[model samples]
Target chain A: MRVVREIALHVFKESVRDRVPYTLVFFAVLLMATSYLLGQLTAGQEVKIIKDLGLAATSLIGLFIAIFIGIGLVSKEVERRSIYNLLSKPVSRRQVVLGKYLGLVLTLLVNISVMVAALYGVLAYFWFVSDPSVKAGWETPALDPALMVASGLIFVELALITALALVFSTFSSPLLSAALTFGLFIVGHFNADLKRFDQIVASRPVAYLARALYYLLPNLTLFDVKAEVVHGYHVPATAVVSAVGYAAAYIAVLVATSVFIFERRDFK
Target chain B: MPAIRTEALTKDYSTGFWRPRPSRALENLTLEIAPGEIFGFLGPNGAGKTTTLKLLMQLIFPTSGRAEILGRPVGDVGVKRRLGYLPENPYFYDNLTAEELLVYYARVFGHHGSEAARRAGELLDLVGIGGERALQLRKFSKGMLQRIGLAQALLNDPDVVFLDEPMSGLDPLGRRDVRELILRLRERGCTVFFSSHILSDAESLCSRVAILSAGRLIATGTVSELLAFGVGGWELVMTNLAAATVARLGLRIARATEIAEGHYALELPIDAAPDGLLRELTAAGAALVSLNPIRPTLEDVFIKKVGGARERATFHHGAHRDHREKT
Candidate 1:
């Protein structure tokens, strides 16, 4: 446990010194700013528009963080040949993977929080100072509850992506791992649509194949609450609970897979 | 008790996308290195020296058989804590300074607070990198990097140290420093296992050595043991006069070269040269100026055992030939 914590702290320090985290933070901030600007074009639906764009930007940037950074964790160690030093210690293989995953997740959390705060600031500023006619669309003057739900949803989404990236990183090269993780992210978001398309297909065998793929991929769009935040629709409490559970289960599966592959890998 | 022991260990690398035949990296080989012994693993490039180290370190899994350290199975985390390994070309985090890198390693080994810091400091100084602790490793010279690598390997104060080509990139002075460090480690009761192609370095540093050729342990023992076994003949340089009379003494004249004045170089069969040949030359009215017998070196033993292109050259020149071959 001490080894895990020590490695986790080391990973955090390493990421902080690297420019990649700061670059991602800057991009996330820019994303939130662009959403606020885009909200202005919505005219009467300014709060709803800002909320929608903010949530989407948060999720998108979070995915980028998980994929780009998480894929390099093990590969970076291997490339630097630092894994020899690390493994030569008393540390276990599982500890290395878990510690690295926690570090990347912590970085993602900090980055996501910053972007969420910026979005909240922009929405609050627009809500208070703007004309009553522009603010009339909002059911409340304060921050929307749906946007909070969306933030929670994005956090879970990013956790899932981090696990997927880590799983690919265990056995594959950094480039291929990143590509596969990103590809899975895209497939996950469109999983529901693909299921619907499968329903329209006539052949039962083809439908079974598509259904299998749908079940295998994460239901990322289910975690998306942007539409609820934008149109002032209430996000059911049960949906949030189930989404959180699903994210946890997915992360557990991927982490296990990563451990399985890493255990057999020959670092030399 | 042996610090490291291997039992018929084998490793094979499979290549090709389909119908791949496994290339054996290490054949069924067994050896034991005692505690506090400086054991040199000498081999030509591609002779499986690195593969053997990798297997012993548990960086790679053995295809068959087993290796153990301190009586524990290889790859056991408990055993790993007592082992320090320096690879052929060590690469470190370019962004981290020497102090930070050591601190990081120390932390991973579960050391923290002042204890970790103090150990890191002591090691950096021990490896002669104390003055450059604050400098990033990226800016370090090759020799400096190697020193830092040595420091990192010693971080856990390991009982068993594995150094692969530790002197490859070092200058003569740097090589001397590393050789001295190995001796110091042995003095401190640490078992040092190092691999190198430099015969002189191995001859000077190792108490015993194992020579590998094509993944097989061709010859293994002390330097003297190998020389005694493989060295076929010796050269006896004589002088005075009467070459025909000296030739009639039944010692096959491997070579007879005339030096200035009455000095002559007589390269005779080693077995015949030691049989009262010096007294015989003097009694035959040939004044023996000097009688020098040339012994075989480690390189000769290595070349003789591992017969390749170089070994063929050495064979033509005979075992006692002293033509210098670059390692």
Candidate 2:
């Protein structure tokens, strides 16, 4: 466990020095700020626009960080031949996979936290500047704690994407890993549509194949509470628990598969 | 238990994309390295020297056979605690300074806080990188990187140090420093196993060496035993005698060449008694300069063991045994 933590801390330090995460977070903050200005032009629906754009920017930036940096977490070491130094140590292959996974998760947490803070700052500015006497259609304050539920689910989504990147990275090149991970992320979000196709299509084989894929690939849409939170609707506690549990299970399977592949690989 | 042992260890790699062909990297290598000695693994390019090192380090698994280090299997993680390895042209994390990198490696060995700091400092000085501790690795030269690599390998003060071409990217002075460091390890009773194509370096340091040719163990023995096989003969220097007179003597002289104004160099077989030659020279009123035995060098033995390029191209299994039997 100590060895795993040491590797995790080392990887964290390495990622902290990398500029990719910082650049993505900076752009997300900029987008959040831009949404504030864009909100005024929408009039009356300014709060909803700001909330929707803020959540969108946060999720999009987090996805980029998870896919870009996570894909290179192991592949970069192999390319640089630095894995020789690492694997020659007393740590097991499982520890390396776990450590890198934990490390990238930590980086995503910090990055997402910064973007969330910036988003709240934009919402706070709106709350302070808006005139209550104008009598807008909705009277609820834009700064709601309920939005955290949306952000938390977004984090879960990013974590799942990060695990997907690691699994591909264990056996493939970084470019292929990134492409495959992004493709899976896209397919994961639209899994419901694949199931809908199964019902609409008359061909039994195609429907069965589509239905099988829908069950096989992760259903990431369950984790998205952005629409509910943005419209000031309550997300059930049971939904949050199930989504978090799903993310955990999928991440475990991905990481376990990664460790299995990594263990049998010969660093020639 | 032997400090290191291999039982018919072998490795094969598949090449080509469309039509994959299995290329043998190491073939049925069975060898043992005893404790507390400097052992050199010598071979030319593509002789599986590095492959052997990698297999022993568990960076790669063998296609067949098995190996053990410190009485544990090669892939045993606990065994690595007593092992140190420096790869050929090693790469390290460039974002880290020397101190930070060493501390990180030290932490992997379960060292913490001030103990890790102290161990890092000690290794920095040990590898002659104390002054460069604050400098990031990206700015370091190849020689400096090699030194820093050596430092990281020694972070745990391992019992058995495996160095693959430790002197590879270094200047002569840097090579000497590493050679001395290796010697120091031996002085402290650490088993040092290293692989190198630098025969001269191996000749100077190794107590025993195993020479590999085309992935097969050609020879393994003490330095003196291997060199003793091809001792050329005895050499004699004489002067001041007519060529006709020397020819008239009928001694089995191999060849004679004039050295300076009157001195001549003479060669004879190992069995030739020098007393008869001395008596004959004195009788002919010639002066004697020096007589010394000519022994083969490790380079000569290595070339003979590896054979010429033509012979190497046709190298096959059981060839090492044929050469051994003939010798």
Candidate 3:
């Protein structure tokens, strides 16, 4: 347990020193600023547009953090030969994998939180300063209740992506792992549509293949509650609970697979 | 008890596509290094020295046979805690300072607070990196990096230390320092198993040596035991030796050469010693300038063993082929 914490702390400090995290944060902030501007162009739907764009920015940036950083965690260790030092210690291979996973997850969590805070500040600015009568029709004023729920769902989504990256990193090179993880993230986001297409496809064999892929790929769209929050659609507590549960199961399976592969790999 | 014991250990790596050949990295190697012994594992490139070390360290699993450390299986975590390894061409995180790197390892090894700090300080000084503790490892030279690697390997004060080519990139002075460190570790009753291609280094430090060639243990024993494998002979430089003196001794002169001031080179038989012969030569009117015995070195023994095996195998195959053709 102490080994896990030590690895986590080392990774976290190293990530902070790296410019990648700060660059992503800056991009997220810029995204929020652009969304605010877009809200003005949409006129009466200013708050709704702001919430949609802000949530999208958060999820996108969070996905980038998870895939980019997580894929490099183990692959970089192997490339640098630092795995030898860590493995030569009393620490097990599983501990190293888990520690890296948790560390990257913490980084993504902090990044998502900061982006959400920035979005909240933007929403709050428009809600208070603008005249309610003039911008009310242009904006359905941002609701704190829906935004909080949306953030919770996004966290689950990011956690799942982080796990997916770790799973790919265990067997593949960093570049291939990153590319495949990013590709998976894109497919996961549209998994619902892929399932729908599977049903509509004319060929039976092709439909079976599509259906298989849909089941294998995580349905990331299920965790997107930004649309509900944007239109003032009530997000039931049960929906958030189910999404959290799904993410947990998906991450567990991926992390277990990673541990299995890591244990067998020869670090020569 | 042996610090490390391997019984018929073997490792094979597959190479070539479509028709793969299993290249044996270690083949039927059996060795037992006792506790507190500085054992030198020597071989040329691709001779299975590193493969053997890896098997002992449990970095990779062997294809067959068994290896044990401290009476435990190679992969046992309890055994690992008491073992420290410095690999060939070790690399560390470039971003971490010397102190940070050692502290990190100390923490992983379960040391903490002032104890960790004090140990880290002592190790940094021991590795001669006292002033450079705060500087990131990226700025360190190859020698400094090697020293830092040594520091980390000693972080746990392990009972056994496995160093692979530890002196590869070190300067002469750095090499001397490492030699001293290994000696010090031996004084502390730590078992040291290190591999080096430099025969002199192995000859100087190792109490016992194992020579590997073509993925096989060509020879294993003390230096003198290996040297004794090759034929021993004595060389005598004397002058004005009577034919009677030579005939009475029955000494076969392999080569008789005249030196600068009327000195003759007399190569005696393998088992004959010049101790008794020298006194006889001095008693005669002959001036015995020099009498030196020519003994085979470890290098010679290694070459002979490897070369002899290849020649014998080739000879057997050739004879078998001729017999088949005749049949």
Which structure among the candidates has the greatest DockQ?
2
* DockQ computed for model 3 against the true two-chain complex using alpha carbons: 0.62
Q: lDDT of model 3 at residue B310?
A: 68
Question: What clash pairs does model 1 have?
Answer: none
- C-alpha RMSD between model 2 and the true structure: 4.4
The reply for model 3, stretches above 4 Å from the true place, is A28-49, A125-129, A132-145, A197-199, A202-206, B17-20, B230-293, B310-327
Which stretches in model 1 have alpha-carbon errors above 4 Å?
A28-47, A127-142, B230-293, B308-327
Residues B49-123 of candidate 2: C-alpha lDDT, one tens digit per residue: 999999998889999999999899997999999899999898988888989998998999889899999999999
Q: Over the stretch A1-268, how does candidate 2's per-residue lDDT look in tens digits?
A: 8988888888879887777567655766576667657765766677777778778888988898899889999998888888888878898988999999998888888887877787788778777777775326654467889888899999999999999999999999999999999999999989989888856889999998998999899899999999989877889999999999988998999999999999999888
lDDT tens digits, residues A109-176, model 1? 87788778877887777777778776666654447756777888898899899999999888888999
TM-score of 2: 0.91
> Per-residue alpha-carbon lDDT of model 3 for B9-28, expressed as tens digits?
99998889999998888899
Worst 10 residues of 2 chain A by lDDT: A132-141
lDDT of 1: 0.81
Error of 1 at A29 (Å): 5.5
Cα lDDT tens digits, model 1, B45-84, are: 9999999998887779999999989999988888888889
Tell me the deviation in Å of residue A150 in model 2: 1.2
Q: Which residue pairs in candidate 2 have backbone atoms (N, alpha carbon, C) closer than 3 angstroms, thus clashing?
A: none
Candidate DockQ values, in order, are 0.55, 0.77, 0.62
